[model samples]
Target: MTDFSGLQQLTSLIRNIEAQMEGAKLMILTHEHREEIARHMVEGLVGPSREHKVRIETSSGEYMNQLAILEIGGNKYTFSKDHQGMFISEINYYTCRITPNSHGILVYHQDYPGVIHDVSRVLAENKINISSMNVSREQKGKSALLVSLTDEEIPQSLLSRLQQLPQVQQVLSLQ
Candidate 1:
C-alpha cells in the first residue's frame, strides 16, 4: 500500500492557496497509481458543496526519481524521494529541497544584494529565529525564491511587514 500521510498536508496547502481563486484545477502526474493518488487528492481538496470549482487530472510520465508532479494554477511543485528522505523538491519553477511539516515563510522577490538582509532585518526585529534557509533563482538579477524555516510561528503582521519590503513581490507563510 502507498503511504498517503503526506498527501493530506499537500492537499491542505493547495486548498489554502486556491481558496480565493474560482474554478481551480489540480493536475497530478505520477509514474504509477495515478487513479489512487487522484482520488486521495480529490478527497482532500473538495467538499460536497464545492466540488464543481475544482478539477483534477492524472497522467503517467517519467519525472525525476518517479515522484508525483502536482500543478496548481500555473505553478508546479514536486514531491521527491531520495536517500535522505522525501522532500518538496520544486516550487513554482524554482528548485528547492523542503522537508514535510516545515514551518516557515516563502518569499518571492527580485534577486539582488541586500534583499536577504532586509528580510532578515524584519525577522530579527520580530524575534523570529530562522532555523534554516534556502534560496534559488533561475538567473542573476531575476525573480528568486527564498524559503526560511523558522523556530516559531510567523505572525500575519510579520508577513505583512515582509510584504511591504521593496524587494519582495509576494510572501506566503507555511505551517
Candidate 2:
C-alpha cells in the first residue's frame, strides 16, 4: 500500500468533498509521516493564516489503515506554539472483527438541535451500532461530529439523507 496508488487514493477521497465544506474546519492527516508534504498541501488549500480552523499532520501507518483517534481542531495554533504533545487515544471499534481496510471514520455537520440524536437515531434505525462518538462545535451555528465505527458501509440513501439536512454543511466517510 506504500505505492503511489495509496497516496492518490487518499488524495482523491479528500478532493472529492473539499468544496462542499467551505468554512468548515478541516483536520488533514495521513497514514504516512510526511510532514513537509502534508504541510505544503494544507497551506495551499487551507491558507497560511490558520486562524479559527486547523490542520494536524501526525504520523500513522504509511501503508494500511489507522485508528480513528484525532486531536481537536481549534487548538492547532496552541499545539504549534506550546510544543507540548497532546495525545488522545481512541479505541478502534472492530479490533476483532474486520481487517484494516474495512474500518474508517464518518464526518458530518448537521443542524445543531438534535443533530447527534438524529445521527444516533439514523444509525439505530439502520441497525448501525455506534461504538465510539466525538462531537464538537466551534461557536454558535457551527459544529463538527466524527463517529468511528466498524464494518458495513453506510448506504447511499442514508448518506444522501444526512447531506440533505437543513443545516448540515458537509457529510463525508473516510476509510
What's the C-alpha lDDT at position 159 in model 1? 92
Measured against the true structure, the TM-scores of the candidates, in listed sequence, are 0.80, 0.43
> 32-58, model 1: which lDDT tens digit per residue?
766666665566556424554556665
lDDT of 2 at 97: 21
The local lDDT score (0 to 100) that residue 82 gets in candidate 1 is 65
lDDT per residue for candidate 2 within 12-36, as digits (tens), equals 3333334433443333334444554
lDDT of each: 0.73, 0.43
Off by over 4 Å in 1: 21-23, 47-54
